[model samples]
Structures are given as C-alpha cells and as structure tokens.
Target: MRLNQFISHHSKYSRREADRLIEEGRVNIEKNKADFNTVLEVGQRVFIDGKYLKAQNQDLYTVIVYHKPKGEIVSKKDDRDRRIVYDTLGAKYAHFISVGRLDFASEGLLLLTDSKNVARQLMQSDLEREYILKIKGSVTKEMIEAMEKGLSLQNATLGAHHKSKIKAMDFAPFLKYEVTKEGTNFSRLKVSITEGKNRELRRFFAYFKREVVDLRRVRYGWIELNALPVGKIRFLNKTEYKLLHQFLSKNDKNFYVSKKYI
Candidate 1:
C-alpha cells in the first residue's frame, strides 16, 4: 500500500491530511520518517506517532437500530435540498453508513455501521434482509392475500409464497395483522423478503391498488424497532447482533423471529 493511501485508510482524514502528516514528518515506517509515496510491502510494520496500529477487524462489530423519521433522506450525500441521515449520525459515530435506505417519505428500522465488511455481508446474503413495513390505504384481507400471491413492481417482481414481509410480529398471534398497524390510515405489516428492491415495499402495496399515505420499516434482518421513537438511533443488543450473524450461517427455519437467516 502507498503511504498516503495507508494513512487515509487508517484515519477518516482525506488524502490531503495524509500528505500534510507525511510532509510534516509525523508518520514513520520502522522508526524512519515515511516518504509521501512510500510503498509498504506485505507484513511491514507501519506506525503513526510510534503507536502500532492495532488492526481492528469488523470482528469489533456494531449494529444500530434507527427509527428513520419521514422526510429524512437516506444518503451519505444528498443532491436534493433535503435533510440527510448524516445530520443525526455525524455526532454519534466516528464512521457509519446507512445499511440500506428508507425513502424520504417512509421511516423506521434503518441499520448503521462503520464496518464495511459486515455491511457487505448483511447486504449480499441471499437468505437475509426481510423488513416489515407498516402502511395505510384502502387495503383488505384480499389484498394482503394477494401479496402472498405476488406482484410486479418498478424494477423487479416479488413472488409471494411466504407470509408478508409485513405482518403482526410482536409475537402475538391475536394481533397477527394489527401489531404493525399504526393508525386508521396505516396497517402494520411484517413482510419478509431475501432481497430489497427500490421502493419495493410501497410498490408491493400498489399491486393491491392500495395507496400508501405513510410507511415505515419496523424491522430489518433481526433487529426490531419495538417502541423506538421516530428519527432516533440505538445500538443493537448483543443477542440481536449474535443472532443476526448466527442466522446468516444457518437455515431460515425461524424466519418469524428474524427475517435474517442463521
């Protein structure tokens, strides 16, 4: 790795900062000041201020549950004149990414992490990432049933063979279809899918001719929003993170417990 690049990767500072550090003779390789373009061979011990970089793996993991409020744009950078999710995160984490996006018009259960490796794992695992979204419209039992039948949306199609990614999943069968309900204008649904297509949740409603006045994801993979307030963030518990990774390595027999696989 190039000295400049290695410095940039080790810290959040940009390449310019790295150049300044190297030029100022602050970085060293084996006790010698590192040149700006020093090529570090494999197994080389590089140091910054004499402190060996303790390589931190995604093995040091974090899973956060954020109740994404409506109108918040899900992006690291927003072109439109709107509030970005970073406004809330910059103060919380030294680094993080919105695991996935929730539409500006929708809210609920968004994941944030600084570990790119784990994020990649969570995003690509085929047997994971089912989210439950609560929505509202002129929907009926038939429409819900149709969701179980399948629908075509903007870019891809959803095949219905399993229960809704949206359903009553508060562990109460009596509230099987109602727990996700937020208001007369909204019906909470625990729908599960192994993949995420853009606007897929809302588009799923369109298949039933139902208009969504509001939508929010109450769950993702294995983490749940539970009673989390809108627009706030919270770190995932040990059990939640452990279960999510474990689910990824196993079969999805307990799909209801977590849309994630184990």
Candidate 2:
C-alpha cells in the first residue's frame, strides 16, 4: 500500500492528513522522509514524529452512515469554524473520515469509515449514489435528454478555467432520473449515477445555465437512508456490513476480523 494509505489505515490520521504529515516532514521510513506514494513493506518500520505507527489490525473496522444536514461541512476540521459533521458525531468518532463529500449546502447519506482502504475502495467502485435535488427552474425533456445522453462540457463549463487541454466531451452517464415535482419555477427530481465525480451532479445542470437549488443524497451503494433522522449517525447493521464487505473486498478477499481495536 502507499504510505498515506498505510498511515491512515493504521493510525488515527485520514489519508489527506497523512499526506500532509508526510509533506510536513513528520513521517519517516527507515530514517528517510516518506512521500505520499512511498510503498510500504510488510515489516517496514514507520515513525511519525519519532513514535512508531503500528500496522493496522485488519479485523477491527467501523463504518457508519450519517444523515448529514444542510450547512454542515463534511470535514472533521474546518478553518471557517462552521459546524462540521464530526462536531455532530462528537469526538468519540473523530477517527472516521468521510467516504465522499457532501458540500456544505448539500446533505444526506454520508458514509464514514475508520478503514482507509474501505473508504478508498467505495469511492472508486461502481456503487451508485441516488440524490434528490431541488432546482430553481423546471427541467425540460430536452434538458433531461441531454443529461442522460451526456454533454460535451468544456473545462470552463466545469469551471476549470486554467486547463484547456482537458477534454470537453467526457461522458457523464446518469443511471436513472425522475421528475418528482414540476412547478412554474422550481422543480424536484431524483437522479442516480454510478460514478461519483466532484460536484458532477450540480455541474451537470450548470452546463445548461441552471443551478441546483438544493441537493440531498438519499442513497449510496446498497445503503439507503430509511427513517434515519437528519444529523443522526448509525452503525451499519450486520447485513449491511456483509454487503459492503463483499463489494469492497472483491479484489482482496482476505478480510479478517481482529479483536485488537474496535
């Protein structure tokens, strides 16, 4: 595994924070400063600020589904001093890192995991995310068709003003969609996408000069936010954990439960 992944999986640090620690010269392997992509050997000694980081106990893992509320950042720490998801969950679960992001204004179905590999695998997997979005303008058949068919969005359309070499015609396929409400100005719709890109759903409508007024993810993978009140955090049930483990362990099928940490 990469140094960042190894550190995050074994320590309380998230992958991003692990990278930051490496960059800040706090992490060392064999008396050498570690880089984010440094490969970790089975018995390699890794020290963070002179303290050794033990290899992760593969058996001990915790994953939770959080019903995130609007106005809360997904990060554990924010400079803006705004209420973050960790604040709601409190310090007890501070070690959990969000699987993917729900922007400050968006809400619902946020996944948090203590296992760095699980977090990485889920985001890169073919799991679909279902979202219920409220927009300020009504969506027409043509607009929906364009979205379903995929748009040739320019970098500027995606707000990438600096990189002109990026292709404008990358296809972003929507798995499913439904118009929940159609009004004179506002509209509510449910859409699903297998691939999650940074702000892709919001930017999809923005390509046509329309903005998503409100966005909430109601489902992710096989997990649904059923009866979970907003801002509540719950551990994945046994069946849910099995399903997630099956999906995440497709490539590495040697998941063992450890009693070392819980």
Candidate 3:
C-alpha cells in the first residue's frame, strides 16, 4: 500500500498526518528515509520518530452498531460547534471510524469499527440499505416511476447542503419500495437501495418538489436496528460476525484467512 495509507491503516495518524511526517523526514523504511509516494511491500518495516510502527494484528478487530439520533453530525468536530456522533458515543469509541454517515437531520442505525479496512469495505460495498421515510405531501406517480426506473439529474442540489459541490447525480433503480401510508399532507414509505450517495433519498424526493420530513435508516445489509434504543450501541453477535467474515473473505481472500471472527 502507499505510505500514507499504510501509516493511517496501521497507526492512529491520519493519511494527511502521515504525509506531513514524510515531508518532515520523520518516517523511515528499512533505515532509508521514506517519500510521500512510497509504496510499501509486504514485510517491510516502517519506523516513525526512531520508533518502529508495529502493524496491528489482522485477526483482532471490533465492530459495533450505534443507534444514532437526529441532530448529531457524523464527524469528530463541527465548525458551528454542533454535537457530533463521537460526543454521544463517548471517549471509548473516540478512535473508531464510522462506516458511513447519517446527515444531521437523519437518524437510525450506524456502524463503526476499529479497523479501517472493515469500515472502508462496508462503506464501499453494494449492500442494500433500508430506510423508513416520512415526507411532506402525497407520494405521486412521478416519484414512483423515478424510484422504479431510477433517475439522472443535472441539478440535484435542491435537497443537498448549500455548500455541497455535487450538481449531477445518477441514481440506480431502488431494490424495493413499499408505500406504507399516503395522504395529501404527508406520506410514509419503506424503501431499499444499494447505493449510499450523499443526501440521495432526500434529493430524489426534492426533484418532485416533495420535502423529506423524517428519514431513518432501519437496516444495512443483514444488520438491523431491531429494538435498539436511540443513542445506544451493541456489538455484533456471533452470527453477524460470521456473515461479516464471509463477506470479507469474498471481497479479499487474504483478509481473514485464520477463520477467526472478532
């Protein structure tokens, strides 16, 4: 892997910090100063500040499910001094990386892991995400068609953050959707989709001039929120771990070869 990636994955320093260290000549590979573009080979030793940076044991890692409540951003800190997920998660999970984010107005199940590889893999995977959404105004035929056939919009910023730079978005067809309730004033639905783009669901509804009043994620892949209380966290059970192992094994054959799940 690249030098920055290696340091970030094996140590607490982020990739940006790793680059800074490289630039300052504080990193070394086999007694030679490392460069920012260095690509480490297997078994190569790396040292920082005269101390060997030991690689973490691949077999040992932890994953937890946190029931995130609305109004908290999924970040370490916010410029506006708003609450972040880590604040509610406490210092115990201060170093854990969130698998994906739930926007400030959205809530529900969120996954976090101590291993960066696990977080990255799960976030990038095409696993289905199920959500329970309450939107203003009745669900219309245009919305149904867009959800079924998918949509490509050049101006998808109606529901996005004002600072967001993404103007165009391509939405894939939803895996499934059920209109649980429909009315002139509001509507509720359960929908499943594979992609996890930024403000995807909200943008889709906004394209039809509908507002998403409440959006809550209920499930991701085989993981479910179930009866988990808001703001609480729970570790993955044996079956869930097994399923995760299988998924990792399929994605990277060398990832979990010891037949161990933690």
Candidate 4:
C-alpha cells in the first residue's frame, strides 16, 4: 500500500496529513525515514519517532446508525467533557471512529464505523445524504427557489460552493428535500445533498438568516436512521450493508483500501 494509504488505514491520520509527515522525515519504515511512494508490506516494522507504530486495526468492519442527540458533538473524544455521542456507546465502540461530523447543536442520524476505509469512501463523496432540519425564520416559495439556484450567505455563494464540492455529484443525482413544516417561526425542512459538506445545510439557511432550530440526518447512502431512538445505535442490516457497497463501488477510485485485520 502507498505510505499515505497506510497512514490513513491505520487511523493515525488522513492521507493528506500522511504525505506531509513523510516529506518531513517524521515517519520511519524499518528505522529509516519514509517517502510517500514507499510501499508497506506485511510484517514490516514502522516507528513514529522512537515509539512502536500502532497497527491500523479498529477491529471488525461494523457500521452503526447512531441517533445522535442535539447536544452531542461528533468527536471520538471531547476535551470539553460535555456529553458526547460516544458516551452512550459502550466500550466496544470506544475504538470506533465517527464517519462524518454532525454539528454539536444538531441532532440526527450519523454513521459510526470501525472501518476507516468505508468511512473515507462515504465522506469523500456526495453520496446522497439526507437531513431533516428546522429553521427559525420566514422563507417564502421564492426563497426556496433562490436556494436551489444557490444563495449568498456569509458573503460567500453557497450554490457555487456545491458546484465545486460535488464536481461529479451532478452524475449522482439532485438533492431531495421536503419541507415538512413551513412555519412563520420554526419552519421544518427535509433537505438532501448528494455531496455532504460540513455545516452545508446550516450555511445554506444562514444566507437567509434562518437560524437552524434543529438538524438531523435521516439517511446516508441507503441506510436509514428510522426508529433508531435517540442515543441508540444498531448495526447496518444485510440490505443496508449491500446497498452501501453498491453505492461505493460505482464511484471511480484508484484504489479500494481493503480491511487489514478483520
């Protein structure tokens, strides 16, 4: 495997971060400085500085649909000691890494998996993630159209942002959303994004100064968070598992990072 892939597969860092470390001569393979093109083989000794290199194995490729509460932050560990989603998850998931982040104030569905490969694949693409959000503002039909056209918020154009974020997202499909509740104070909306961005939903509404009252992810890829009570989690069913594989397989990639220890 490439050095960058090795670093990411091990869960120590991302592929991009791995490149920088290798360039800085911080990573050593068999006690020598490593390069990005270096290939990692089985049973090879690796050391980060003088310490033993941790093998990237979170154990068992398990994907869980977590009903993250509104207050929980989507982090492996929270330094602030506030309530975290992992706090409800038992020690089995202690090593599990979150796939994507749902803002601390947002509540909804999130994917947590032990397999870094799967997480990377889903998060890296705009693979049809859905959300149900409640916004606090008055937005008419025309405003929604403007949203489809993309609006200027925080002085940055969000529609153009989507254009760039999802270069191939167009091929994937248009985002599907349903306005569940259109209220003068708290308007509830179900929005979909083929390409999920960090705080993209909130940012889109921010252009209209529509504060998000609540945001929850209802679906990702083919997995649904339905009936998964808040602070609860369940493994992806057989159908759910197959659907995800099919979704990822369609996306073109140079490599499919295989599971190391399963």
> Which is the leading candidate under TM-score?
3
Worst 10 residues of 3 by lDDT: 253-262
lDDT of 2 by residue, 229-255 (tens): 998988888778777766755746775
Candidate 2, residue 58: Cα displacement in angstroms equals 1.9
Ranking by TM-score: 3, 2, 4, 1
TM-score of 1: 0.62
lDDT of 3 by residue, 1-262 (tens): 9999989888878899899999999999999999977999999999999899999886678899999999999997899999999999998888799998999999999999999988988999999999999999998999999899999999999999899999999999999999999999999999999977999999999999999999999999999999999999999998899899889889987786445554
Per-residue error (Å), model 1, residue 156? 7.2
In candidate 1, where is summed lDDT lowest over 10 consecutive residues? 167-176
Cα lDDT of model 4 by residue, 1-262, tens digit: 7777877677546678778878888889888788877998888877766666677543346788888888887775678788877778877787577888887888777888877767877888766788887788666765567646654343434323343443221122235657777777888877777765656666667556677777788888678888889998888887676666666556635434334321
Tell me how far the alpha carbon of residue 2 in candidate 3 is from the true structure, in angstroms, after superposition: 4.7
Per-residue lDDT of candidate 1, residues 143-178 (tens digit)? 555555554334222322243354221111111233
TM-score of each: 0.62, 0.79, 0.90, 0.71
| Candidate 3 wrongly placed segments (more than 4 Å) | 23-52
Show where candidate 1 strays beyond 4 Å: 1-40, 44-55, 127-137, 140-145, 153-188, 245-262
Task: Using TM-score as the measure, name the better of candidate 1 and candidate 3.
Answer: 3
Candidate 2 regions with alpha-carbon error over 4 angstroms: 1-6, 14-52, 156-171, 253-262
lDDT winner between 3 and 4, please give it. Answer: 3
Whose lDDT is greatest here? Answer: 3
Two-way TM-score contest, 2 vs 4, winner: 2
lDDT for model 3, please: 0.92
Per-residue error for 261 in candidate 4, Å, reads 16
